[model samples]
Target chain A: MTSPSVPAAPTLTPALGRKLHPWPVRIMHWTNAMAMIVLIGSGWGIYDDSVIFHFIYFPQWARIGSWAAESLLWHFAAMWVLAINGFVYLTYGVFTGRLRERMLPIRISDVIHTVQDTLRFKIAHEDLTVYNAVQKLLYIVVIFAGISQVITGIAVWKPIQFSGLAEVLGGFQGARLLHFLGMAVITGFLIVHVALSLLVPSTLWAMLAGGPRLKTPKLEAAE
Target chain B: MRSPNRPATPPDAAILDNHRAEIRMLERRGILRGTLSLGSLAMLTGCDISDDTSIGKALRAMSSFNDFVQAKIFDPNHLAPEYPASMVLKPPRFNAYYEIEKIRPIDGPNWTLAVSGLVNDKQAWTREKIATLPQREMIIRHICVEGWDYIGQWSGVPLRTFLEAVGADLNAKYVSFQTADDYPSSIDMATALHPQTLLATKYAGETLADPFGYPLRLRTSTKLGFKNPKWITAIEVSNTYMPGYWEKLGFNWQSGI
Candidate 1:
């Protein structure tokens, strides 16, 4: 009753799955996901509140909150999370060479081949450790899209304080347009991403658990 | 390419008209298809945007709900930050529904600001009378609903002073303004009483140019540029709600920064 005994370390077992995602990447991934959901929902609420596009009216049910003020509160609150998490993700990715290691060495021919392979329904399921050329390209595009959204968002939020930035984006109206387009593009990516995840359920499981559940060929061979 | 010598004929005109009709048909199909998707989504939510009246009502309800939330959080004592004089944009950009050239020149001498509604002193205020009131100046950013902003140096009598001088019922729910340019707008009593709310008579140390509101204009640092009605002609204090020019057109009524 006085002191609890420390348990001995268990015997090492052979590795099963490859480490597809590090802890930081997985944590930031989920945080970014939550932030994106709030941002998009509240953003739609704001759009309905002041509707820049007359032709397209997003359904009221899709709104994040009942009121514009409420939506704005949610939006700004989520914005801070997204910005900080994105900054950390980018910095870590760059410094640790993870970005270059996982997403780079992508060639034009590789992209062309990936597209052909995808269209032919012949995407190889063997390699979960590395992103396909198309996936890498999409990830790169999403990174730029996120950056653009943040810039345009700042321009719209504090036009007076960041007048130069707004001007660079072709003034406030231009920034608003760009911001909306970025959201649409991100939404498109999210749809495709979810669909792809459904196709390979392990990818989602790997992201959630931080490693693949099944042993890779290399790991099995090593054992 | 047609032969240079060939004369344009009725059959050719018929063919052209047929082509035009086909294009119109295609355009209509595209629009119909887009609306069909939207209508189906609306149906899923049990809110039909197909009917104009119901959609308008829904939008209005949402807007009013926003107004209530904004009013609940509004702080009368909170002041918008005053920018440095150096931040003031020279030749502040002209903004309005119409072009600058179309601005109707108001006769400054004949212009009398009529005050009405829940006020005890419903006197017609003249430019001379307004100029006599204690003046205040500040360089503040003018944020527009369209998303642009510009810092401007504005000098005028504090709106609170004008309201007190006129014996306005500070307890009233709202204060409305009618501009000479046919724009009608209102602010919440809390915002109206805010210290930064100004009955601006000068811009950039000079009398307001025609492009800007001339003679007299409401310049509040707390609200958007559209909320600051240019060439203000009348002021009314009321307990009831009144929508402004842009507010009537779906912009947020409580458009605080």
Candidate 2:
């Protein structure tokens, strides 16, 4: 009962110091978030220059670069930061095994249960250190989306140079649409993540400073 | 489905307020993040940081870095995709910085391609003299920075051959074009020498349309559409950077495809 993180994560709890995000994790998370914001806003600006869809339009307010050229500059500049930071995060997460420990072994049953409970306004977030199946799925999906954005972005940006990648994405126009889709998914994730953090303020506090040092979760072993 | 360790309560207003206060009291790191995110939010509502002098400078610097990278990555021998002659568009889309009415059609009979700058032979070229040079044709995608694309067939002397014939300094950093329409543009030396680079005289086997550079235009498959200035007036082989018409207006100078 002393190992109190999830359905069971005995091997990870103490090693991870689950109450606090590691310094590298915290640093990379904030930096990645900032760069993502810049990328999304600038991307909107560039898309507006010659929109792929006639019906879809983003107002000037929703854009970063005032002009198409300036938007491209901002987009490229932020891309390097996002890419380098993402690479570091991936290396750290994989090498340290944090990605596996925190977000692996998702069961479909658990996901269904979580969804049913969420619809009924029942959340099992008593432990900030543990992620439900839904949470794990979301984190993994967002990471994949981020990687896909980079790939598709390169395809459109240099369709001739990266012809194979463009072909993979169904050519130049296809690459642009896929990149936009990635942005939409990430935006959706951002909304849900922020909302959840508000619902569980302690989790936000924990992210900022390690949570209350629980000597034990009233050990289930005590009967 | 509450766990045995559950708090048995939802977060209250007091908790939210306390965390808000704590966030406000955090050190410079938190404040900096707050300001940045706030600025991002402000940007979403029409804040124009692009107009800021410092930010403009930073964006310009980034564009220059992109140019540097594009130059480094450009493989001289890598040809842009060539289309079949059948794929070439008839009456290709005409595009220029100005309206159709503003097209300054070159007076072909009076036209002479004045060559200057770093060149061994400064002799100007006439349409009749250029006609005598070996002619080659290519069908390549004309990709515009505004996101449209067209495939067109252009016939002309390969720019490399013409440069050699004119004794232009091939080693020069740039070959700038001043067009009859006053739309000046320049390309990198590597692109200038690319096999697809042409001093185009005809489009789709017909002499150029008045609106599409009647006498001669510079066409390079390696660069964006705007870099291919129409209605050529002068050619300068130079070591110095010559500001292009669009580049002066914030478009990246090295607009390599």
Candidate 3:
């Protein structure tokens, strides 16, 4: 791979893609991302609704404070949206076979070397096209994180029905702790995702426009 | 140029040659449409397999463990404070489940409690025998784990008197309560003899309903709603501790609401 990276005069040029993201994948992916953000924000609101947080309490509008019944309802509603959207997206990805293409990490040594080179800043920005191993791992972890939120959240919501579950996790209190921790992890990951998007402008377009663009020579070598 | 087996199926050779560039472009950029499709598909395999592989075992362990821990926490000798009727939460909420099926029989002088276990004496006490011994009354909140609270007045004979009657063995660490409903619960011997704990029959001036453990019930303010067992039938001092149904299932065995 380094042999090809010898700073050779341009031999390959990028061609614009006619097909970007498949419509379903694009829709579901973006929606899932948005839904998670809303859910996380609303979850924070609900958690703080009951407690008087540092120097501040939730405004009266934020909660009826009529024994927290309203906050509880909001939590349940947001949870349903996040769960349903995630389920549909996951199902479609499997049935349609798009998951295979997007999720499989680049197995070739060349891609690994390319990632190392990019990390070292040895490779020019042009040489980067394939997502590095780190990206693949983050994406996968987020998917599982969403799952954790749902499972732990259920353990909190209906400790009796899911009592058996509550028992294993050390009961309702334990489940609540896990649920809060899961949200925190997701929030941290989102911060990193946004930073990366800024680092590489193409990331935004790639998701929005469907296919990422490789500056010409890399595209040529790739072809 | 296709082989006979391929016979008219679009030849891989031709398609490969034609689409190789497009495929390369898609692959190189990682802008492929199927990223989530692949990830989600893999996750699908993980989804249906209920995560609680050892849920049953954990439940059992926890129930027993909770009882053991709660026993260790409170010295049954020191009782929870019983407040006057003024301290009761007004409009007491009826939460969880409360019911009564059997009442004290008319001319009811003979509700008896059996004490058996690692004790020197195994005996049964008639209601008349218990009432004659010692009586205590106080009001306290029944804090439900489900987040409801209610305070009710209770009057009952002390469990210590029963333990003293049976002469519980010094080594006995646990006390098990067998309710008339066939629902048996156990707590630490210390919890059993808690000062505020009682084998009580009267609730708010009337005999407890069968659902409320009619003849007698155990009440401890330190623990959550469920710890208070109703319908006292048999009290056994034991060497080992274990959890009841709810505790085994996943609730905090201590369950101090």
- The CA lDDT of each predicted structure is 0.77, 0.80, 0.59
Q: Taking the tens digit of each residue's C-alpha lDDT, what string does model 2 give over B21-107?
A: 666656544444345443533332223333444456676788889899889878888877777889888898888877888876677
TM-score of 3: 0.43
Which parts of model 1 have CA positions greater than 4 angstroms off?
A: A1-188, A191-223, B1-53
Report the error of model 1 at residue A169, Å. 16
Considering summed lDDT, which 10 consecutive residues are worst modelled in model 2 chain B?
A: B41-50
iRMS values for every prediction: 8.2, 3.8, 13.4
List residue ranges in candidate 3 displaced over 4 A.
A1-223, B1-82, B87-110, B209-211
| Candidate 2 residue pairs that clash | A61-B44
Q: Please identify model 2 stretches exceeding 4 Å from their true place.
A: A1-14, A210-223, B1-52
Model 3 error, position A79 (Å): 22
TM-score of every candidate: 0.57, 0.84, 0.43
The order by descending lDDT is 2, 1, 3
Candidate DockQ values, in order, are 0.07, 0.19, 0.02
Model 1's DockQ?
Answer: 0.07
lDDT tens digits, residues A53-130, model 2?
A: 899888987777666766777788889899999999999887766787668768999999999999999998886666
Select the stronger candidate by TM-score from 2 and 3. Answer: 2
Instruction: Indicate the residue-level lDDT of A208 in model 3.
Output: 76
